[model samples]
Target: MGFGDRWRQWMMSCISIPKLSVLINGSPTAQFGMERGLRQGDLLSPFLFNIVTEGLSSLFQKASNLGILRGANCGNGVLISNLQFADDTMLFLEPRVEYLRNARRILRCFELAAGLKLNFLKSRVVKVGMKWSKSNVWADALLCKEGSLPIPYLGLQLGARSNMKTFWNPIRNSIKKRLAPWKSKFLNKGGRLILIKAVLASIPAYYLSVYKIPAGVANDLEKLQSADGKFSVGSFRIQLEDSISDFSVDHKLVWQDCCPPKVEIFNWQVLRGHVMVRQVLHRFGVVQWWEVSSCLTDSIKTWFQGWHGLCPSISHRRVWDTLFAAVIWSIWESRNQLIFNGEDPSLTQAANIVKFRTALWFKHHGRGSKIPISTMLLNLIESCRESPPKKKIQKEEELIPPFSLGLKFNIDSSARCSPGDVGIGGILRNLLGKILGMFSEHIGVYDSNTAEMTAIHRAVTMCAETPGLIGKDIDIVSNSKVTVSWVNANGVGSLKHSKIIYDIRSCLISLGNSRVIFNSRASNSFADCLAKKGSAMEGDFLSREFQ
Candidate 1:
């Protein structure tokens, strides 16, 4: 039976159409039959709405194949179809009468079968990429308004660069609206911090997912902190310290969370206003030596602009991004220390911190990091300089052994920093080294070790579930010695990762014939690449790439 038929049967058998009290302007008009289908506050309303409209998608697909309906083709060779979210639908079709008639007929069929009506007047026919003189004719036929591109779809301002000033207006306006009421109320330092952290910071977080805040928007946001901005230097110091503690070492959210959205580090240097930061550069004699200005921001803008003018490649860009983040964080930390302690913040100390932090961050998070930390600390440019020709990497003997029987699985995980975005990936291979299956997932906010262990556990569980693997000996390979040691020792691990170790042990027990072994990171390159890609993803996701 069709879904509509099934739903109708279920409704008839289960639901009662009792007369609902009709309230009109504070008075009951009269008792009426419950004519409309869904309850006003049904929890399942959205889900049911999706189910009702799901047929429309298939109908459009069939029509597209039959050449009765058509959609715009993307540059990537994918056809654009109607976008749907619950009841809201945007149909993409050629401005042809036949397509319009078929769309109308499909809607009519759906309305009759599902007992749901589409509001034609509220819907708009939007034309994209092409100017259509007959747009009105289609609008009339569809009985909906005619619209154009640059219209709002979902919550995003649809047809513009996400970082454009127009795109940030809503976020700016929202901040203004929130600040208006709070401005009148006298909030103390603690209360102001609370409001900023809880209410103000959360307002733009959604937008942060796609676009980095422009500098003007960021400055505008910082202006909202005017009350706290006027605090004594000591108060400022304490507040800065407290807030910094809450941020991750990488300060990803904190950095990206604020305005002037994160972009190329070179651009960030040019855009940010660095008032007191010149002191650090002057102390280091960087500006004087680099032949840049006394103005810190100007000097940075000059230095980086010249650097990028050299047109660095992808490898060079990665190195610069790490060095920039480390320097920026160190400078900010030093500024806070200068204020709080009433002692001069040593520029040398800040530079050293930058070197240390950048080295650590690059070692783990940097994809294909080639430059050594000693070279990066001493002079990043020197490391990037074209070196004397060297021999290419020679093929090494294979360290990984082919499984003689059953299955062999390799797993790896990546995280940007401790308690940061993490991803797990695993690949299953047969005795012939043919890939059986591969999976990658962006598991949110886990330490690196925990993520590694999770990857191992997932691999074991997946192997157990694989068909024809029952009671068969399976081998699991991992690059993480720590995770392998935990499993080899039967779940005993450092106190910090005890929970993950226990889970790994449990998964191993379930796969009774499984054994964990360590492999060099080079041998496990495929899983490592998958883990890196997964880490870049935003949410918890599991993907099966092959089977």
Candidate 2:
């Protein structure tokens, strides 16, 4: 059935607002039935042709180790565990690069082990929800036919959760488990400041060290250490010390830039308090928030309350202890933003937002003892404050690829649109910015998703044709991982549009590169911006940019 661009565009305008995300022809779309439409073709490949013999053996062994495959299942038979429709396919071999030597060994192993030829095209590893949860979004490494990053079944996107609530449980539970001892110790008689400081200073320093302030954020810690006195906040006279220091903090004292207030401090030690306070806030935050998502949410309200036959409203008394505290912190920050930066966010409005988001978070994920998925989301935004500056691509650099023989490669699509027209473009570059040529297509009436797919198709065509394009160190970059996964995840020849699939797979087989990558639109803005050019065939594709 043909798709409806007008209706989809109208719906897209309503739900996916422009401020929070990219406004395209529509929400990013994927090639859903790409693999389902495959027809009778030459399945002239070997079973383990994609991986090396040792890699193949190791792949089987890893499955056995994971308890995913054992006993009779381990025999030399081709082990295809999860294959639903022609679309979703997961193999049960040793999906590790450590097991194999170069890409060549991998190809021979497939023929030797499964007696099938390596269908280099249409074969790539996929991870769901790493960047985009849509069917096609994917990491580029998995797209590499040979040198491409192998999507080892045992390994996928790190820290990926199955559902919002369950995902945070382990982290949530671990935090609770660890803090329980400390909370108990603090409540101990004579626990006093020494013990309190010891627990606060050490536990966070050790446990959350992974969440350390990035080097860029702390780059001048030493210089600031000496100048701590210069940046003092109040009578407290705070500053960073080579060794940890302590000063009583009133949560009311410091200011934070986050709309929901953060404590302001003269010195960095405020962060120590912030961490513990935020921990407490987050703990109660999750507890209270989960109640709604797990219960009061509109769709799941009935089911949530119905869980375990308990009165949903009757949650533990302690859950609400810090509920207002978290809200207060948020309001405090928003008020400060309006006052100091003239941001103009009302205190009442800010509190409502915090409440709404907290409730929605729980509706999607419960605030159980486990770390909630929203926590990760929050942290991702917060961490950007400390992350190193992102590298911007230089202009006109990809015209000629760097020195490397035909190495393996992959391509990803990128697109961005405006009110009138949509711009679609694709770039084929390597780790080093060797331009292996790129393509741009424009559809006057298009949504963001369709434009994105067009870019991917164009990129695939370019990669498949030109000689020496086959096995060069290649990487495909796109802002949308969803597009990459949906189109590249399936077997090429299997798709009804077998030619597109075949061309992509053919590029992988021919190239000798590492992998394909899907980046955020901000990072891949260059090609995407290029793709949206002027009206002429070669006019600046970004029609909106000119205006």
| Top-scoring candidate (lDDT) | 1
Runs of candidate 2 with Cα error greater than 4 angstroms are 1-420, 434-438, 443-447, 491-499, 512-515, 534-547
Tens-digit per-residue lDDT, 1-547, candidate 1: 2557877877654335556677878898776556556667765566666766777777777778888778867647777658887568887766678778887887788788777788888878776433366777878888889886567766777656665677778877887777766655544456556756568778888878877777887876765655543546545655677887642122232233212244234234433434435555777676644555555444554554454446466446555555665666666667677788776766677778776675656554543267777776677544544433566653331345544466678889987656667888887777767777888888777777788888887777676676556566778888889778877783366676687667767767777777888877777778887888888876554565435
Error of 1 at 177 (Å): 1.9
| Per-model root-mean-square deviation over C-alphas | 18.8, 29.9
Q: Write the per-residue lDDT of candidate 2 for residues 409-464, one digit (tens) a residue.
A: 22323322223355566555554555445555555545555455555555545555
Per-candidate TM equals: 0.34, 0.24
Top candidate, metric TM-score:
1
Q: State each model's CA lDDT, in order.
A: 0.67, 0.42
